[model samples]
Target chain A: MKWLAASALLFAASAVAAAGGGTRTNDDAIVGDGFAPVLSAYGFFSDAQAQRPAAGVTPYRLQTPLWSDGAEKQRFVYVPGGKQARSRGAGLLDLPVGSALIKSFRFGGRLIETRVLLHRAGGWIALPYLWNADQSEARLVLAGARVDLTTPAGAAISYAVPNKNQCKECHGAAGQVVPIGPKARNLSAEWLAAFKRAGKLDAVPAVARRVPLWEDRAAVPVADAARGYLDANCAHCHNPDGAASNSGLTLTWEETDPVKLGVGKRPVAAGRGSGDLQFDVVPGDPDHSILAYRMASLEGGISMPELGRASLDPAGQAIIRGWIAGMR
Target chain B: MKMTTALIVAASALALAGPLHAKTIDVPAGNNAQSRLQEALITAQPGDVVQLGAGRFALSDGLSLDAGGVTVRGAGMDATVLDFSAQKGAGEGLLVTASDVTLRDFAVENTHGDGIKSKGANNVIYYRIRVTWTGGPKETNGAYGIYPVSSSNVLIDGCKVSGASDAGIYVGQSVAITVRYNYVEQSVAGIEIENSRDALVTGNLVTRNTGGILVFDLPNLPVMGGGNTLIEGNMVIDNDTPNFAPKGNIVASVPRGTGIMVMANDGVTVLGNTLANHGTAQVMVVAYPKAFTDARYNPYPRNIALGYNTYVGGGDAPGFPGGAQLAKAFGGTLPPVIWDGLGGPKALLPSADVKVLNLNLPAQGAGVDQAKPALLSFTAPPMIAVPGNVGAPARLEERIVR
Candidate 1:
């Protein structure tokens, strides 16, 4: 099945190259129309086709991945009009107009949805596409959809695709629609080296700061693992620049303030989402923490990350619990 | 392909006109209606109107509008429905973050989260809208039916909301707001205004929720010190529904059957309202010190006035915890007005500072107990007015005509 999926991706890429005539200049790629320009001129999922990065499309991996209804995700970044990827600070290189961040989600070997983040003159805009059952095509989905499927663990679940506006619910940072997960701390040394070998890196810094992947059991400390998990799963909206900033909780990896990182901190207007707990996080007591209660709840009014995943992430929950338990 | 072509034409038209000319983009009813509507919203000019036809539109994801001065309208609240029962994504059913935007005459149902939420938007109006969950009120229901947070110059009128586990119509950390002529029921809190400033809540029918209405100022928020609010001329009755709010939320502290609860706020005036048939007190005013865990918050309820309100048929069955506490403090049945006169050193100033004027209910039926000493007064900082909502556009009254 893995081999079949890989071949399908390769075939889709070659087909896209054939359809768009391989190499194209930046000037010809006009995005005046919604995402049609992305499809026809840029050949980024045009014809509802599911395609991987052809020649210049570079695949990358994050140190930690956000949880999205337990779906497997594939990520690719494309520089606009075949431009070189240039590093900006410790984050992913500054993307030019027409640059695209493409992520495809799959459930049990079935392609489910592909989310594309397009960088335009106006800023970054997120567009999601739903794949058809036959795997032949995917169509741009603006409203968003809900699908019911059985996971590999045999749990039946309802998965939501998230609408265009829902995209900004997390992506909107510092009052702008921006990308997440490509920050300096999320890049792996090996991936950076590969990008440099591919001539995609403008300049790789010496001793690049790294956030250990949540599943990298051998290399990460318990505290670092917990923080990385939070950064990937919650910080997109819980950061100082994110939507939940009003709550006074900043889950970003860069947050140095202990209170903002939810140490014995109280909830502001969490309403009943507080789970009757007094503190957002209580050191040495997972049972007494509001964060643990919210994460464990499947109820509508009291879930963390608030949008995706109807079921609990027992492994993630255990990690958070263990971290809280071990805290002073 | 056809839809894409249409979207391109629309985009071209919008690009040519700049932000001046107003255009109408009609969205047909179908499975793809959500996509089409989203496309229109993305391509719409500043003054454009996105109109939804009279039909049920099935949507998998939520929708949003981020352009200023855009109006999204539908045939009627009941006629045009956006159903998200099978929602696959996360977040509110519709999220709007644009200033000067107006939404009207539509229903959002069964969302995975909030029904319609506007965040940090100014000069926004929600007119003749309905937000609901089909099932009865439960903890699994969405947190809010209609939610506007950290926004300014907001108006929500002639709307119906129900089946939220939290407040059905909730406005949080907002300013210059007006909520009127709305019907809210079967939620934990019928309508809640929290940590906001310069608000007016009146002329609404609030019933069957755990609590009728709430005005609160919580600690540890970016925007705090909510004051200068008026709650008047609303029917707050029979709010005896059990609380279904998740734990840890401040509203969970509210007793079931509460009519109006004012906590830790200042300069609030409650007048000319009808309160009836609540199992708890008709009105309760209390300080936040005992319940608060955040030391940064103000623990006093100051400069409050409660008068000219008609109260009837309450204290039949005391609510648990608070009601039980009130019963223990002041005999068997709960009072019409229970004031836990706990304040931050300011309680010693005078009994008249927090006035209860011309209340026709029995004097004995009102309870006031100051738990703290008056000698330990803490001076409060000056209240800051929440900016925005100046010269907001005229309210949309076309729904009444329709």
Candidate 2:
């Protein structure tokens, strides 16, 4: 939980350094400040088109993944041989230098984009790579791209691939980039244990309260399912130290204070995004809650998770609505 | 003496760093502006100048700069324009996360969000920048125009911002802010200093906004305990624009034609200002008008000092509730100063010659039903003496002067 790795982006070099050593993933790409120009240059995959990981690359799943316009995600944690990631109680795992986290977003069986969190000498740096139309390889797209496609909800939308700095907008904490998705509570217990047994993690973390699996949310309490979704999607930027800290709305799972969590809390600088509505979350009224309202918006300034998601997630919106509707 | 020496060093540093190892990169406005501008921002190092050329640069996504000690200069506010009307992604037009940055001579129009925002960027200067909505004042306009938050030693001068749903120039959760010589119109709050300490607002032409200038400290914010600000030497006039801010926002409650308002803050002095044509009182001191549960929050305005200022052609058409009743007691119109009677004895001190009204309310968040309005004749404005910490550093003042 205390892993506030020093500034990984402080020494990002413009040149593409040599990626030497490591028969699996490229060690130089993970250890150095230089960013690889191509996604395949990092060597995290044996069969890039088939989504197959190399020898040391381990695939894992989050309990409730971030909703990216209903895109299917394939996740992997790449740790060098003999180096284990430190597992805190419930916070983000402390990956050593020369480690990387990879996530690929796929829509309609086609790879759209892949984001990588590389732990270098200084800190963690987040980079986005866009896959070509052939699905054979992906190139580094620091400027980001927009693909016109149909979402899972049968809506035609222009999906945005976040630029490099936009990657930091969600991943940054106190001006430094850090990983957000690998918190112990957000990861499944089985995955954690298996990863530990595989010598990838230092130890299996014990989560006091695990977030519910999004697919099986019906079996859990409404608050857990809904709050879990929020913790995974909104908490990255909404936490106190995150990019949207000025808004003072912290959505972390441990943020139990009602007012701090935006319950009946008035908007300070929401502007037109507030829909002239009052309170971020009105008890028992999902329609009036600004949280639900922003989640459903597709406009540039009005949308929640402003950097990502050009289209709305109806299932995610329903979870937030359910949470607010159950509140009293 | 120590501060003067430090400021001299700061000025010297700025001058010395300008020529050495500093190269200017000129970027002309044309197709592929989004990628070109964004790439220039990324490749720019410290002491580099990203010069924007004349003409309109149409952008789709928001651009950001993270390199410290860099300057983004444009041809002119009118000549070099960044139009974000077709924006598709990002929250604001430009987001700066680095310190010691200078953004100047740029016009940002029709942005889907804030025009230019510098967060956690200390020692930032925004000079001669313009942010406007061509469609005029509407509820859909972006929130803030010149927004610098969570930083120290900030300066915003010679800027023009209009049609913001929120404040035109907003400095929040920051310290040592100075907003001066700016023109702000058709916004909810012309220039707002919120949840910050040691601010100076002066020499601005603030007109046609819902409220001229606001000094507020609200609850549940990351940074609180705002105070020690001076609002002075500005021509605040005709701020009668209807509040077009979205509902639930704090600024939406601002009464139309509000000249100057200080709410829930401490040690704020209102002095040396020219005001006119406000339907609300020219200057209002009130508490936070909502019920909050934060233990760290203080909802009362403390030690509010009001000075003698020029007030012209206002106080007839009152916007807030109970203004009619207060005007009725005065036989025609209300006074120039209005205080919500919630703070204790030390709450207010005003000039004797200046007319004052006391909205005698019982408690915080009380409505007009509990108001017992009357003119205050006993309270006298004390001599205004603020701490030396107020306003931006002298280094910033030197830059504006040059």
Candidate 3:
């Protein structure tokens, strides 16, 4: 029976078991063991505002809304190919600093949605607003989700939910450090106001919640941008226990401290007769940038971040290339 | 009464028995072939043939053979398919790590890595095997279609290979190997022989690769270039494309685009092979005897010969042999041959002068079109190529299924 369950687990990732768009029927339900219980199928607002949410709960006056106004007028952040139909939002929940949110979208009742909590280390930092967790399966985490703090009313709030594994899978390194480059994590106005009051930013009135940051792009150096991209993409599997951890290209934002990250150094076990290409970054030219060439390739030889995504966005690619071009 | 009943029953049973026939295993089209293949292999004996039905079977991992020797032949090349589309990845399609293995027909498509690999096994014959990556001919592939390594006494005959990230048919560190009558195109190297001895590569059609045929003795391998080998009867054509692999990583070790290159090797005979418009050189020999130890084997090839082969230098320019087919793409005239090895001056007999043999056979000619003279000659004191000194065509005519 355990083997049966294990074999059934392999098919779940390949084929979704949820009944949607008439894709599932009674027969398909038994195609594999429908392990989890079925929850309702609805969007964020629809599911949250329902009279009863799974267990008994009534909706009170809503502290925050899923959308600005209840219409499609709220634009999806434009990814290169399509709109943000697949993106999810995360921010300081009004519930409490340590509160957890466990929402399950109907994958045969498997608890698919996860929200992580983190206490602010530096003064309250607002992640530059962009699409961070841009997938249905993304486990969105809040930096303040686990802070052991007293509310203004003096009520002790602690993170009640269990810790998540997928957060580390997604954010890799700099896990709780809000990713503020390239894309945003859909920060909320209440969180922004709290951060400003806490003196995290130079004071600006917290009106126009979803104001676009189309301001002249800040002059962050290319090195920072390239490092940020590497942290976001490569650090996940390049660390210890990762498949390429042995190859020693640690791209974690913290580990890539330049000196530790082999940026200006030659690689080990590279350029052997086993057909290994040597030198990940060759300083200056993109043609000389082995890392950049590998990132642009699809063959198994050089393609990095071997799973999940396809090609890197052209604009993102340019920022990394700009950094490599500056390297000696 | 008992004897009479027994005789009647025996006669009836004998009458019911039918003629003996070979067992036929049928794989219906669109069936899961990974499991079916496993079952067939388990149930089959010698001389048993499994007919794979048409259409693609989304296979998981590669099929492994545990038996001593057997053959898996297909009805049509494209008809029987093993697809690794959703199976993540595996080493290769069919892995034969045992001796006396024979696999022919059918095609392995979309494998994550190598298409077919036989590692450290000998007495293997791969006939009419077609291994591709994109389900069809496609450039951005993973690596070698037919790759055999660390083995000996192997024969890969009458196979069609194309679109590998690495060489199409690569034989490395093996001896007494025969690779002939194959059509290879659009790969990094059509046929590559590295650190192997007593091998014969003849009667193959090679085109549009980074190099048609490459013989390299890589530094830091256990085997030096194998000696006393024959490279003949092959239609080696323009191999001008850069290797399809990403340039940054480890592939920088191999120099690109030489039709027939002998690097750090000896006793190599390049005879009766038609070479046309190869980038860099039609034939290049880098005989570094000191490099032999770094190449893993001592006593490297001490003799190399080139005889009786035609050279079509592609476009209208003076090439080799008094400079007849040298085109402008060859970077003016022809590249001068420099023996970057031991016996450097002595290897150029009668003169210490360098020479790059140009192949300038007319495109439309009688025997000269298919046949050509060898580019260079080498007869040192110690080593000799097979059959002593004989002129033979490198490529042989292929048998078309039509």
Candidate 4:
């Protein structure tokens, strides 16, 4: 009888936990709920959390994640301060859910173009549209609807970034799909929501919430840094099915895994001649290393990752250097 | 008849007693070059020559000469046909494992792999020879026409080759190899020298293939590209298309699509060659300094000379966003030096394949005429000499057959 009572209590607790621990607000869930309940509660908390003014009053700003065009349509470029909008061309971003995307902010001018993608369970797929930019006119093609919001309501509806669309192609595979890499792109919204429920969001800095590469040092290990750099730069051609497939050096994160691929072979004859490096990786010394030499060399014979935005990123190179330096 | 035979034997004895500077061996119709070669091996000793007649004669496979000082020559390439088509064996055609083996004016055809392979052999001279495969110019052909690896002091002169998926003429891990007066065409690579010490490539005509010429210092090899490798006075043009093997081959795979691709190589001298009409670039040099084992000791070649050569049709403009800029981005600078007095010139290895058409395509008409009256300049070799597309026209040639 006593055992039955104990078991019943345990079962009830587990059931409650399974039902989101009664922690997540109704709006926190992607399914079964709208944002009203959580929005009202958060609004109340914002009021209480507001601190009193000490000196000169500062301009108040409340940034929201929404799109003026509609909830179904995702905006590629959202200039928060300018409250401007842009759209990629047609058939660019019909991406599968959970795919990775990378966007580049090429121009320093007014309008910013961003590329979006989705990381699906199978592989990286592109969101078939692209954002084009001009001075005055902003439009979204294929999906039909161009909304440029310069007012407060417009800014409130724009999608919050540090989003995947900001750097989709920058880390894209093939043409514009976000392939798997040494680093993950963005933390899933569910994971972020889970952290919010666990009260870790306030502690996680804005910087930590940025892209995977820009996240706090705690997010990734040093050993994985080289893989991240290679993926961002060289994986396009060094894989099994790329133009450089004959070289036999698959720079993909999965193929380059030391134990599995045995990339340590001195000569990769299967590679033909491109990656016929003396050593794939030396325990110590990056300067004497062939991989490092290719990365550092500016010559056509040695420079690596063939083509893209041109020139190696100094910061990214340094990160890879550090990782190589760490290898014992 | 017996008296005539005795008089002939007496004359032979007298000839043997004379100062034997140039040795000679007679090869008749019934007895093949291999049998005569065996007899010559027994009698005349070192510094002897095996002279073969002009005839369609077949030979066995796996003939290696570990000893130095032997010469194998034929009356002419057309007359002395050595067909190894029937023998499907491993190894190369006419392999000289030792040094000082001189061969001239013989046609070696249908070799399973490298037609003429000399490994660790030095002071070898192959002159006026034709190394070929049975197939015609479609690429799916032979491995290498004249392949010399880890050898030294070699001279390849007046040879004609084609139909190789790899380099029609390849020299690797060697030093002091002079390649001149050879006609190579319609192969993966026309001439390739890799991981050698010091070499010279001059006065050759190479055209209408995948890549033009290449000097590479691959990793794990004992030697890198040699210092003072002079590539001069050659007509190298139209190394554009990919090397396709045996017309209907289902398994031969060659990575064509570039012209002159130089990767992981250093200290080369490229001078005075007419290059044209490439699928990708006129010249491409890809180096991997980080991947080098002894980067400090094995200094990356600081010198690459590209001068006084007519370059034609790489499908890119002359200036800024073209081949020159790409070269700088990769590590090479434009306006490479012309020449140095000794043998080779000085220049920088290109970092990327440069697309430049310094000359017009097809090489016909008065404006584009490359034919100089003096000695006809260059010759177009027959496609049967080189078979497959294992190598590029001017790059490293590799063929691995299971």
Candidate 5:
């Protein structure tokens, strides 16, 4: 500890850490219910500002990522030493009891907040750690924070960092907190195979139909691009076992029913989110659809994915509108 | 030996924590009240009281409570207020997802969505809480004021709500609902019990909304078949606000000045209510006037009983089309009781003393022009027996002062 303080890397506020994943991060935070006040206590990052991964931490990406006011996201998963994560079908990987997932949200290359999900013996716990102004450290904020930032499209917006309970609003299913991402269908097969070679995953589980990469959405089918976007962004809370299940509009990629996927479906309790639109999705007319209407709204009650977003994503709006317009 | 040591450690930890006893955690409104109040709620254990002190807590995000057997109390309805005029996130002001919880004596104002929503939280009580939009009735105001959905044994007593674009006190997909002694005004529909059953709505003063009281059953919901409700001893008056409900909502079809409208439900009894001064007919029973694809849904109102409800000076201007001409044809104002004459058990009706108009439509979804308006000749059946096992469980009333 004294030698590290004497070294120059300790005070590097914005500098990148040395490419040595030498030290294994702290393991006690993942196994216990104790709330570590500082993000450095978890030891998940060798350099907190540059977002470097420590030893036993593996970086991954989702095929279609949930957009957060155009913030860049860096994702990682860390299983305890000798704990192999099991995968089944296309569901979320069954990580061991002491596993943890880390994701940091960034805007203009400055780290805004890092969210961590620790799978303890009881269940998974979600914590939001807000980075300080100096880019040196982040602390756990149970109440979340609001940061004024400009989106990639140059729209100035007040970004909402979701609180702890809002985490379960997306990650929960069947009344229990669980992970929403890291499914075989969402993750790349190359990463799955490489992770199996590294002895982290038990096997490369078979996936029924993988979601098309978001980068190649325009080149792919319109429904694939549109439904994949919904699965990544809206389905987390719109599925049958989701927070918006009361709305009766399930947008999961696997949902094939037209009415269930908001085709000619009337809103249950949409209120002003309807935007005076009559149906959830009107074929050949995206402007008349409530689904596209809500996606384009920046108003509080009128917006879809009501939490974790404060700005409009033009790409998402265009994709959904195009898909709905293409429908016969 | 190792197991015995672990048991001993666990026992001692339980003794130290004492999770059985109820604890009171006070949260005063001050600097960083968002974090202070939200932290108190998230960390509150079962059987704990998260007491909010006397002041206005300006909140940015909606607060949530997911623990069972908890109580969130404020100093008083006027003393402590949770203001969400600057709210940035979440659909509702407060979301409770746990069972056996009690919320009382708090005012939630100007939320972006519903004021308080308890979803799938059974045996919940909302007593003396006030939810108001502050601004007058507008299309942009939040949908519901006090919304309890998909729960059982819900008791909403002595609450107040105003300026909701939708129903003020909306209980949906629930059973054993008791809504009593509530005051709702300037909302689209006051005191709506939708797609639910076994409800007792009494002693409520509903006024100045698009419609006063509504019992509706719609299609395509997870829960349906609303029936066996009692509406008695309420003052439903002067609900003449134009319909402010947004499009696509079922409430948008509610005509202005409707005293009590029952739609597509079975065994709904409206008794002993002083219904007065409306533009539409005082009591209207109709079917769901749309096409639905739900196989399990019944789109007809059935077995509706109107027992001795006092109707005074209404139907001067019917809200729907051709109402003035039809009333002129029938001498002056329309009758007090209006029926679409689509479906019925037919035995459940008002006595012959009450004036009635039967819109003998040919089929469902028929246009109002096709209506063969005629006087309903009623031979009254016996006084109906009230349904059993309605209202919230009697044990929940023990928590409130009234």
Candidate 6:
């Protein structure tokens, strides 16, 4: 009878292991024993390149993507056990446990890095994977990488992959690791409809605010373009509830207060980041504005967004400069 | 069941043996050095030491250590350098959030923001570290070289810092801190202890900054009620650098050429320091109500004792405006010690509220306004009580270096 009991216990333990309940080590490697693989013996995005949900993952795109040193980005959201994403009015909905956000960054069609944000029981953990030169498999990169690449505009730029802890510098809100983009204000109508059609969304809001793509120059006013760029790039840190809340600058889409929106506003703790410019934004003068000064420089301590870009964003800069020049 | 029990017993035996061994992780020097260092930090066990090889490692993102009792040592300060001139991620060059962590013998240069920042971490030590921005002082430099905020039991020794837009070495909202044997230059404020309690700052060489050293208490921060600080045995000289801090920052108001400026703090003893060649007054004591917008702060500076310091070659090219009280009092040449005399009604008494005793200087080196009235005289309302127990008085004996 004891021998029969021991056999039953061994069978149960094997069953648990097969069910993905096995122990996993927390290390720097991206591929762990029980981790979900990025590609499944097929080409990149073979299952669902840019369409509906496939293989427990849903393809998504931001209406206005954050500037990342002019790199091309593709984003995907994966929900474990086929759980759907609930809808909210303002920002991103609270995701369920075991959810993952995967973002792939490519420079000049060359895959550079893939970042994964996994929502676990503890909190959101950021994991970065650096793609090999052959573009086959990406390995986990716990420390960041510095790659010197030339931009399409023929400018030499050094691209940086953020380390895991550096991820929290922008993702942290109220001391918790949270997602920055994918707000209702930043979701295109067609994308929202696609999520609804695929049965991935619980409830779409009645009226979703839209921030027009800055590239669609004719559709968006110059001011709206500048606001959209700032909202996508700087609002993650400069918003009232964001990481730089202590600075008293809020760059959210809905911010109405001129001071909080950085209109003629002085920086609180900018130190040398002010670039000797008096105001964060100067009306009718981007030349003398601290905002433009920080955006134009790559060598100084006064860069905007303070991270994730080695080269200047000329398109974004032009829009903001035009807006500031048009202002009375 | 027998096999499972036997496996568990073996794991338990291994766990018991783990504490007996100390792990040493030697990080290889290469382009992926930042990632390897971070990986080692993440996987480091207690009492583990992570050492960096001698080379210049270019890092784009900042590194962090969240594990307690971990030591990160590098091959001497200049030998192992972490260059963040092209940093693309993270605000601080290195941020530490774990207690009982020691970082030594490395140089962090040209970070996007503060060079090394510790937030709310206790028992942290930074020894023989050099933090610098390669280019000369620019308005676009990083804010701080060494910044520790809201921490306790901190020691920063034998460090060299320069080219910070704000303070080269700044300790804010902390307790039981000791900052000594550091060389600071080319910053706005060389060394600053702000809104802290029980700090001992000594044996530091501060030069060519906007202000040599400052002790201030500002309102609306996580920590307040700064007092009982001792400043002694330091060289503060030739701090004529222009203030380039942003307008809204409080440090922007500090005039250039100040050796030491104490503002709205209490129970500070300035002793045994050498001061020289400041463009403004060597030392100035002032109130906060004139400068700050916060209503909850204590505006008055009381119980300030200035004693036993050597002063020379200042009182030339005063930076205060011509109409300012300080400019009028000293006639464009400031005395070694000048008090603003704005400490409310209690300042009217004949007693020495701001004392200067036993200083080996000229007779007219110090000036106090006996009849000057308080500026903005109504009594300040009570400060809002904050949560958490007040930190106990850190005994002076505990701070003495044996």
DockQ (C-alpha based) per candidate is 0.42, 0.69, 0.05, 0.01, 0.64, 0.33
Fnat values, candidates in order: 0.51, 0.80, 0.10, 0.00, 0.60, 0.44
Supply the DockQ value of model 5. Answer: 0.64
Question: Measured by C-alpha RMSD in angstroms, how accurate is candidate 4?
Answer: 27.4
Model 2: clashing residue pairs? A7-A123, A8-A123, A276-B247, B350-B381
lDDT of 6 at A121: 72
TM-score of each: 0.80, 0.94, 0.47, 0.42, 0.93, 0.76
lDDT of each: 0.74, 0.87, 0.48, 0.46, 0.87, 0.71
In candidate 3, what are the lDDT values of residues B1-402, reduced to their tens digit?
Answer: 999999999876445421232345566656555656654654444434556666777875445553334566676677777776654322456655555556777787766666787755566777788877664334345567887776767778888887776778888767777888999987777888776777788999998877688765543333445656788889988876665554432233334455776655666777778988764566655543221112243332245566556666633332223334334444454543323333333332212122444232222121223324233443533232354422112221121222
Candidate 4 local lDDT, A290-317, one digit each (tens): 5665565432223454222223345455
Model 3: number of backbone collisions: 41
**Candidate 2: tens digits of C-alpha lDDT, residues A1-328:** 0111222222122112212333367676677645666787778887878889888999989999998888989999999988999998999999998899999999999999999999988988888899999998788777778899998788888888888888888898999999999999999899999999999898999899998999988888889999999899999989988988999999999998898788989888788789878999999999998999899898877888787687878888887898899988
RMSD after CA superposition, every candidate:
8.1, 4.4, 18.4, 27.4, 5.4, 8.9
Among all windows of ten consecutive residues in candidate 3 chain B, which has the lowest summed lDDT? Answer: B391-400
Q: Residue A161 CA error for candidate 5 (Å)?
A: 1.5
Q: How far off is model 3, as Cα RMSD?
A: 18.4
Candidate 4 interface CA RMSD, Å:
22.8
In what order do the candidates fall by lDDT, top score first? 2, 5, 1, 6, 3, 4
Query: Candidate 6, residues B1-402: lDDT per residue as tens digits?
Result: 999999999988567535566578898678666667787887676677888899998886677876777788888889999999876663788888677777889999998788998875687888889999889787667898998876788888889999988889988878988888999999989999988888888899999999999988875444677877888889998999988776656678788888998877867777789999876768777766333334456866767766667888786766755424544554545556655665653322212222221112112212333333222222333222121322322432232233
- Per-residue lDDT over B204-294 for candidate 1, one digit per residue giving the tens place of the 0 to 100 score: 9999999999988877677788877888899998999998887766777688889998877876777788999887768877666333345
Q: Model 5 over residues B358-400: C-alpha lDDT tens digits?
A: 9998888997899999988755445755667789999888767
lDDT of 3 by residue, A1-328 (tens): 2443554454343334332323222222112322211212211122322212322111121121121011111111111111111112332222212111222221122222332222122311111111112222332222111223233333343311111222322333322322222121224455434433543323333332231221211356567656655654565555543323434457655563452355543332221112343456656776655567656654443344443323334455676678778888
The window of 10 residues in a row where model 6 chain A has the poorest summed lDDT is A24-33
Query: What's the CA error at residue B286 for candidate 2, in Å?
Result: 0.8
Count the clashes in each prediction. 18, 4, 41, 96, 0, 2
Better of 4 and 5 by lDDT: 5
Worst 10 residues of 5 chain B by lDDT: B344-353
When summed lDDT is taken over every stretch of 10 residues in candidate 3 chain A, the lowest stretch is A68-77
